[model samples]
Target: MNSGVFITFEGPDGAGKTTILSMVANHFKEAMVTREPGGIDIAEQIRKVILNKENTAMDPRTEALLYAAARRQHLIEKVKPALEEGKMVLCDRFVDSSLAYQGYARDLGIDEVWSINQFAIEMLMPQLTIYFDIEPELGLKRINKNKEREINRLDLENLEFHQKVRDGYYLLMERFPDRIARIDASGTVEEVYEQTVKMIKDKLAK
Candidate 1:
């Protein structure tokens, strides 16, 4: 059996999950820090296609499939090997993203998207998922103000779509309460970072 701890960070766009995750990674220097859809070379290529702003014609189901495909390669090339070596793995996103973005937000059934990911991951689920919660308006506001952040295809989605994504995450939290820890993300960066660090420390202690 694998011995390492697998933790995933998740949130709506501009919920600051990526920034907070980077800080958390610094605290846990020994952990393997990575991101979904772009951890390894093959996955990164797929990520480019999925996130490319020019890919507006991409179908919802196709988007979901591409995410699953990237996830599979990332697991094989990075996550599984690190876990086998007993290293703590902290990932920016994972299957939960596809479930929220493609499944619920895209109007596709969550169960349907989940079934596709099941085949790719084969039950490799994160031991802990830190979900940063924020209002869709605030999240989008932050994204628009951040010049350094890349404007992906998803970022261009309407406010209603983003709200749906947040709602999807809420549903997921209810579905997996035991595994997901929710944190208010509207606070300052330092505040969110502190909460995230504490959450990870608490989990590691367990």
Candidate 2:
């Protein structure tokens, strides 16, 4: 059995997941906050290749595999070790991202994507997942407003693709309702943060 609590944050780009996670991290003194595709050195390198805007020719299967690879490295090098030490781990994105972005949105089967992730991480799964729900249009607008953030290849996808990504998340919620919590992401940062903190605290209490 795992010795620590593992929680993951999921959302469409600009759904305020990163910001809210940062604020919530401050509340948990023993919590470790990390993001996928680049939580460690090897994974960070793979992240660059996956997100590079110039790689427009990358295959969907190839993209999915790379993400799984990075996730495996991150788990081995950082996440599992921290969890073994009994730290609360708050991950920015995890296998759910592949299920959404690559599986449903890209027309690859969700089960297919999940199979690969399972091979990568074994049976390890988050105890709780906070999904920031928002309309794709609004989420894209939020992303565009952030001038300092790098525009990755996924950010360049058309609006329809992002909508499908959101739909995919909804489907995953149905599949794992007990594990995923939905929070409205259309409010101010403080409002969203408050909701997130409450959900997390409630989960911990249980």
What do the candidate models score in CA lDDT, each in turn?
Answer: 0.95, 0.94
lDDT of predicted model 2: 0.94
Best by lDDT: 1
**Which portions of model 2 miss their true places by more than 4 Å?**
none
lDDT of 1 by residue, 1-206 (tens): 78999999999999999999888888999999999889999999999999999999999999999999999999988999999999999999999999999999998889999999999999999999999999999999999999999989999999999999999999999999999999999999999999999988898888
lDDT of 2 by residue, 140-202 (tens): 998899998778999999999999999999999999999999999999999999999899889
- Per-model TM-score, in order, reads 0.99, 0.98
Q: How many clashes (backbone N, Cα, C below 3 Å) per candidate? A: 0, 0
Report per-prediction Cα RMSD to one decimal: 0.6, 0.7
TM-score of 2: 0.98
Q: Tell me the RMSD of model 1 versus the true structure.
A: 0.6
